[model samples]
Target: MVVDEQFRLHPESTAYLDAVRGMGRSVNTERNYAYGLALYLTWCDERAFSWSDPGFENLLRLRNWLVSTPLPVRGRRVQPVIRYRKDG
Candidate 1:
């Protein structure tokens, strides 16, 4: 069920999800893949890179960005939350 900001199905990602489901991958695993793909796609869009063929160097840059950037908070915070913690 991966889609873009336009709410259209990303055909390739949807196909990939279908394949993994056929192979008996768990729902949680599929969910993780979907979100990761979405994140990568969004990064590509923001940086004006072609998601289908971002160069290796750009991908390496993305790896660096992943560690350097603080992830967005998941929901409205009722209390103080630590920044950049992988888990809390």
Candidate 2:
């Protein structure tokens, strides 16, 4: 079981990660998706939530969180810039 700085450990997670890599997933892709899943699980634990919850909202929230993480490219963290004007 590999525990990163985030302190998440699951041997099953390791097997899943290895399976993806064995199937020719890029190292970065495996790393990112695995880390994201671990983070999501941790979030669920903190909130006392379960994957069995019959709701799509939680899944949507996870997708949103993934998009919100800055993507590293060309030695930089880049994200699509969005701006909204406050109307009073």
Candidate 3:
């Protein structure tokens, strides 16, 4: 339930954030979501995406960014260092 100083809620983000929180996420999890989403939006800044636009390449780039992020654990950097995997 963290809100920015301007108090504007991003409509597209609420449902996903709530779903993750409902799964018993902690404060750190919330922070991660916020950080990741902020970066994602920044990446999308000059690009408007839609089915009628320049295909789905931007969507894949966002997915790639998520896949490359590593989660910290007990002072160790673990392998398979990604949030999600693409099915082959």
Candidate 4:
């Protein structure tokens, strides 16, 4: 089991990560989830928001930020665009 410093500081997050591993999830999947959670915590810290109890508005803001944030890949960066469709 790999222990990340940030996860150590956030016990709840560490427990969640441990649960993910206990579920027989792949190491890569676990790592990805950990990285994602770390990013969320960082975002919350930047805004002095409570990561454990983020309100709906804050969640929406986080979603918007995620959409606009570019991810690095293969020495290049790519921004993910999400499109919503209206359906009956």
The candidate maximizing lDDT is 1
What local distance difference test score does each model get? Answer: 0.82, 0.66, 0.62, 0.77
Candidate achieving the largest TM-score? 1
lDDT computed for candidate 4: 0.77
Q: Candidate 1, residues 1-88: lDDT per residue as tens digits?
A: 5455678888888899889899999999999898888888889989998999999999888888887778667778886464662431
lDDT for each residue of candidate 3 in 1-88, tens digit (9 for 90 to 100): 3235687776666677888888999979977897777666555654654322434777777677656754433445654444444433
- Which model is ahead, 2 or 4, in terms of TM-score? 4
User: Between which residue pairs do clashes occur in model 2?
Assistant: none
- Give each model a TM-score: 0.77, 0.51, 0.47, 0.73
Q: Model 2 over residues 29-52: C-alpha lDDT tens digits?
A: 998878767776676666677744
RMSD of 1: 3.4
Clashing pairs in 4: none
Q: Please give the distance, in angstroms, between residue 88's alpha carbon in candidate 1 and its true position after superposition.
A: 20
- lDDT accuracy of residue 13 in candidate 3: 68
Clashing pairs in 3: none
**Model 3 ranges off by over 4 Å:** 1-7, 50-55, 60-88
The 10-residue segment with the lowest total lDDT in model 2: 79-88
Measured over all alpha carbons after superposition, the RMSD of each candidate to the real structure, in angstroms, is 3.4, 6.9, 6.3, 5.4
